[model samples]
Target: MAPKGSTFKSCSCRDETGKKLGRKCQRLNRPDGRWSSTHGRWNYQLELPPHADGTRRSPLRRAGYANQTDAEAELNQAKELLNIAANDQALARQIADLITTAVKTTKQLPSPEEVRRKVRTGQHLNITTTLGEYLPQWLQGRKTLRESSRRSYASNLKLYLIPSLGHIRIDRLRVADVDRMFEEIDELNDLITRARETCDPVLRAQVKGRRRVGAATKQRIRATLRSALKKAIREGLTEVNVASLVELPSGKAPKALVWTPERIAQWRTDLDTHIATMSARRKRLWKDTPSQGHGHNLNRIDAYVGAPRPSKVMVWTPALTKQFLERAELHRWYALYYLIAFRGLRRGEACGLRWTDVDLDVGTVTIRWQIIQIGPEIFEGQPKSDAGEATISLDTSTVTVLRTHRAKQNAERLAAGDTWHDTGLVFTDELGRSIRPNEVTDQFERLAMETGLPPIRLHDLRHGAASFLLAAGHDMKTVQETLRLSSIAIAADTYTSLLPQLARQSAEDAAAIILNAEPAR
Candidate 1:
């Protein structure tokens, strides 16, 4: 109910021009006007407090109630809505605005839920802000994300998210809308798969040779959406996070497979046969194929016919790794390769190693910095994790190799004299500049091919190191520490394939410990 001294009045009259003069008749101004039971209507005018600018506000007046009871009911509801004191001008204004909107729209009173949301968020009940507008603002406000992370988030927003979900209002987003976006992505991937399978390799390359977005990419896109929605929720823009309710295709972690003896033999067989067959066919089909002079080269039919698609991460067995090292020993970057293969140093970490971080006398190498490539240019950054920036104990043999490598580098510096760039990197080009990461990968590939070894990616050498340690009976914890992995779980997960054999011995040892207890049989 409203405060004391509130009531409803009625008015009914006609103009001399015979118009139905609603709220405009001169009789409405009378102190004791006669009530018309059949034609007069009830009216209430709420006397509100002054406005925020210290000016009087026009009373919230409404008419057209059929009777005083109806008029009193509306007056009661309005009083309940504006129950705040006069000094709470902000809230008083909100109630005034709410009633004005109700009158204009002629809708029912705002629901309790809607009313609470509006007051809590300090926004109108109806918000028109789009996800597209909020996402950019969210990215700008994220000050702690790394440069690489920010770039990734921006790419997802601009290239994938904004085009799909940007126009939809944040509060209006639905789970079905997000699901439809992913379904479209899946349909496009199907088209990409069909195109790749049907077209010749040369034609596919000419068609830009784009691959379908993978499960991992989709997962990342969802993560970006979830993060943005969380920010919106924090700002009280929306009540629920629809993105959090979405499900995506689970991404599989790439397994690290070692180049065992059987795999090595199989690889050798495939390479020899593939090379001989392709060589013979190329000569015979030279006339049938597209001309090489115009640079519109013909695609190799052999490439499409059962060409090898290498695993993402593959490692060499100890013997093959030793052979590879021996062959690569004659190369200029021998020490770099040795460090990577033996010490499990990442390519970027090895490239980023400075002389100040290496302690040959102490037989320890302190890893601190890494050179990360973004597009063409590379810059120095911290290690992958805090644990990655660690002091790794080196074998005496590795120390000797580093000593010799330092001597060779000094000689090159003396040869260049004033021309040497002096980058202070342990591994560098002849001018003492940091080596490009791609150059290292390409060189490793060429060396592996020349040595007639089974193919494996450069990063696989680090996997091989972990496998070697496990095979030599080192604990997973030790391997984790040596690799500077953040946790033992990661080390174990990465090398789970090598654990069963070691676990069998431990299982037998456990049985032996309890052998004194006789079996029931």
Candidate 2:
């Protein structure tokens, strides 16, 4: 184990002259000698050279024991480490050096657990690796992530994580550091809010330089750090995930607010006042002094004054939805509006719909694919989840809209002749190419503005559909199925705002049931 003839021997010195004989001195060299009381300490010479190729050449030796027993025991421990290391010559060298350093310099042994971990993950027990250095490698190895997901991860890392926590060592990262980053982010949000509130061009230009990072954005940034740290743990870079320990302001799911009669009235009144006042102010300002900066200044002023802060998830009442559908009939993509408003198809799902996925004969459409957007580029990808790919039964009214839309589309195709592209989609541009999702949203906004109705995003149409179903007394589970949400909990949480109305309806139904009972039979 300790090489041939490698055993405990006491340092002997009978001669005090010249080289002084060292361990080869004659007095203490005898095997049977209980003599030489002058030799007080025992020493062992164990040779352990660098076993790995390209490793720096170094002598591995440990000594200075009070007795031969102590010397042999230390030798046995080194032998055991060599046995464990086996074929890993690098590990064997590290273990040898670690043991040697313990005996010679510090007289303290390193933990066996720490030693093995360094060897396994190739971290070499170094505690100075920064998050910035590690996260890039971690993301690079995440080859299985989709394009959109990868872009999101990269964006969070570049825009938030690296800028904030890049220089902090992986092992030295603390929960306090993570918390401070979020606190700063919250402060940045306040700055953005102030910038938007101020109409001063210089103040707005200075403060509105960066996009507002909201609570949702902060949560995503935390998720990115948490995910990266998890990889570090698996690779044995750090024992604890500090990111997991930090807490941030939890982003609440924005409740979808429906436009009631009072809200519609307020919206109309505000719109008329804003337009009339803005027109008069613009005319007076231009007549007084037409400066070069007048146009730019007026645009900025209008953005703050006239722009309405829409709810995160806004919905329209049943009457408003009906009116929207009736007006949308004049639109070329009336079938698209009808399908989303009734069936609750997502914007991407509606855009990705092909004729093959839709069955006009059976009155059903299978949501199999969705057009996902990363920046400006769009690609047809599978649904967000397995539940997202569902076959929804279309109502008779929707089927009729589809038929009429198909007839009109056929007429357009005939007129275009060879110029039309054969995309075979249920909804597309006039040239038959796929419609951009953002274009659809912009069109929806313009149309809603034209109708003088409350503003709602195109995605909110799906929320309206869910609200309609719940209002009709359908179970939450049924709504979950119709929307193709991954779980009933999501459906319950999202539509929980509607529960108060449902409760009143339930109460009325209970009273009617009792009143209509037949003689307590």
Candidate 3:
């Protein structure tokens, strides 16, 4: 006999009308009126507790067990799960609803331990949430992320993560699925590359303004996914972070290369060739469409051939640096350029520096703030890292230049009188307003080009500072401290190639030590 209290029994025999006889089937009972064992499959039902709102709930029902033992085991498991919510009606209702949904959909019972964990943590009891559904909610709840970081996470989710893997159940996400997303990104990259290379305007237009998803960006996307899944794990939504298991190509930064005489020569030749090739292509395009005048074609070619840099990163030699600075000395923001070139201040840092942070007598400047540009807006923010906020020692020449720049700024302030906006920044416009970081960069580029030196970016001034420190025989740790880098490894990795002069001098010194050594036993 099956146990009593919301019973367990078996009945598969159907009446002639074709409806299941259910518990009323005749074979369910023996001739003596005891229950029969082999007539039909076993099933069970139990009265569920009332809902949290005190409304009635249908009794929990499950069927299709092989025998009474199987039916009793499942019934015991259900009772155990329902017992987890003892004394908490809301939790009881949640567990009952979860069981009902699981049976109706997947037919798989959630583990009792897992359910208990979700309850204890107050996580969502629903186990069927998809990543697409959860990621946006997770991102919305992240109240402390920096604006740039939040934007990155949002972009990754909208463009890559959600579009590719959103439909998969969060619990069922696997490393292979993540890997396939990156594979699709790679395929798209191939398409973009081909589209950009094609001469046809339609082909080019199809991929216009779409940059390749580089390895570093791929790494960032993975980081965003991993972070989301990590929170999910903490919330008991997932058992594993499949994103952490996938491998990716190294996203190491490109080492800074010093622009030597030979490299500059080669770069000039390459730039000339690139311009000529673009000119020829433009002419062909113009020939194909005679309605587009030659002037329009020439202007387009000029815009397209805007002096592409030879490398992603390049630094200047001491002589070149001197030439550029000498030319920049005539510019109004010469002190800004000088501070960055010598003291390793970033563009934003220089623009953001205030007179109060500078100690002319002590020759130290604290880097507590930086002007960060997000899209078109500018805002003051903390330095990139804790190390970036520390005070850096300024050279005597730099102190003198800053003093002069202060005097010039004071004069400008006097000239503006009531109109002057006293932002207190060291670098500002004639009206005493804070200088935009991009304006500083544009001025740097213009001065650099005017100096007739090989091209380098405004930020490359930081790289040049590292090279200068290395060439002057400073140790890597010293360079790290001077540059205020977060780690010595960053300094070493970026400046390992060093200036050619330093390498040559080291080579000569090593050879001399061996050549001058006397023969020994």
Candidate 4:
């Protein structure tokens, strides 16, 4: 029997009341029976050991291992893992080789604060609480970008980015997780475009085959998001900046639709049928009329009577432009097309015209205000730039068109008499006020649907004008000025469809000039 005071070799039995007993302290005997720690110290049980009577025991296991060495090692590993998990960042990296050597679960586990302290050399991080709040801030600092760029970002976010990423926490966002989330954006864009095919009037709906954000714009948004994190870091809000280490997704260019002349023409014509612009223009005209008049007098007999202002110039694409002219009723629409197409005047410039601005003798139109859209109010503003407000020479055809249109307006003035408003706009309704921009766009669309013309839009007249000029052997610098394109690159990019034939024609012209040159006599 093992001694009670010293370490045991074997158990010494003692029955109840301290009476002498034999084999009672067997290795299998527990305090109650023969299978517990109270037995001599051999713990080799498969599960819970059987009683001394030879009955099999039910199965059970301890939380930890039996051997003291094994238990201590496991306890240490658990402590290390807990410590690492405590970090504000998942950047708490572990080295596989040093697993046994490190003092991790020094007897038990470390607290989150203690673990955090040990790993955070200098960094701090917090998870994104919500996605919507961060995106507008990301867009605010983009002041230097072109209006087109800013508009694109605003549009794309509203349409694509926000709906997907809005709910996720910014800090908790991971590259892998974001990648997974966005994997479907491409598919969704495709589905959206396909679904809208029957419904889309312009067919200008975008489908993202590749990433839309440019490398530079992506950098800007990332910088903005990072700046927010930097503020958090500066304020000691976190121990690590997760955004600092994150690698952004590839900034590949998006696949764009081929803007062919035929396609442009088709879309222009198609839009008129689907969108209700014709009715919109008529509504504006009706609102301007006196209750007594049955319809607007195409020929105002009284030249002194005022006219209702024409609506704002609608955006027209190449396909639908013809419908606007046919429906405008006044010969003025014909002249408007010539000015927009040949003279390259903006909607406001054309609308703001007086009989004085046009010189049939000189075939010139002086440009001044091109119209400005300021909130609910319509106001006159100078053209985009000083150069944009200059006069343009027109050809005889345009002059003839204007002459005819002028005659029609004079007749309308004569007929309206006291009922007409005296606004001096050349393209006015029977009552004289400048037309609303929205009404003009709507008119073009309605005309397009009614006439079944190619789906050319009204603003497309400008494109058509620019395209025509480029095709006529004009230089890009001149075209840029004529179109008032913000830059030369823009003129080339946006109007490429118009210039394909012109490009080949130019080469042929150059070839003819070179080969047919006569030697000096």
Worst 10 residues of 2 by lDDT: 295-304
Q: What would you estimate as the lDDT of candidate 3?
A: 0.81
Better of 2 and 3 by lDDT: 3
Runs in model 2 with CA error above 4 Å?
1-51, 54-124, 127-133, 140-151, 162-211, 265-292, 295-311, 414-419, 502-521
Candidate 3 C-alpha lDDT tens digits along 312-339 = 6788877789999999998899999999
TM-score, model 3 to reference: 0.68
Quick one: ranking by TM-score, best first? 3, 2, 1, 4
Q: Over the stretch 1-521, how does candidate 4's per-residue lDDT look in tens digits?
A: 11011111233456677864433455535558534543433211112223335565432211323343454444444444434534322232222112212323232323345335534644332222455666666567656654434554555565545676667655444555444434555465455533233222222244322233334445544454455556545544444455456566555423212234445466545444433343343344546654524332322211111111111222233333444555654534656655776667777667667766667898777776654433234656556555666767888877887788777777887888888777667777765557766566556555554564433445666766776676666877888877666789867766654455446545666787999999789
Candidate 1: regions farther than 4 A off: 1-133, 146-159, 162-169, 176-213, 264-311, 330-332, 415-419, 500-521
Each candidate structure's count of clashing pairs: 0, 0, 0, 67
Q: Which ten residues in a row have the lowest lDDT in candidate 1?
A: 294-303
Q: Model 2: how far is 515 from its true place, Å? A: 26
Task: Give the TM-score comparing model 1 with the true structure, all chains together.
Answer: 0.64
Deviation of model 4 at 286, angstroms? 35
Per-residue lDDT of model 2, residues 401-435, tens digit only: 89988888888888888989999988887778898
Expressed as tens digits, the lDDT of each residue in 1-521 for candidate 1 is 24332555546566677767766655544456655456567887787656778787677777888887887887777776676324466777767666667666764555555666666665455455899998999999999885557766887887678989999989879999999888878877776543344333454464352447788889988999999988888777787789889988776657777665556677667766765665555444444555523232323332332335345567776767899999998988999999998999999899999999999888999999888764455777778777898999998878888899999999999999999998899999999999888789878987877786777778888888888788778989989999999999999888887566335544655676799678788
TM-score of each: 0.64, 0.66, 0.68, 0.42
Which is the leading candidate under lDDT?
3
- Pick the winner on lDDT between candidates 1 and 2: 1
Model 1 clashing-pair count: 0
lDDT agreement of model 2 with the native: 0.73
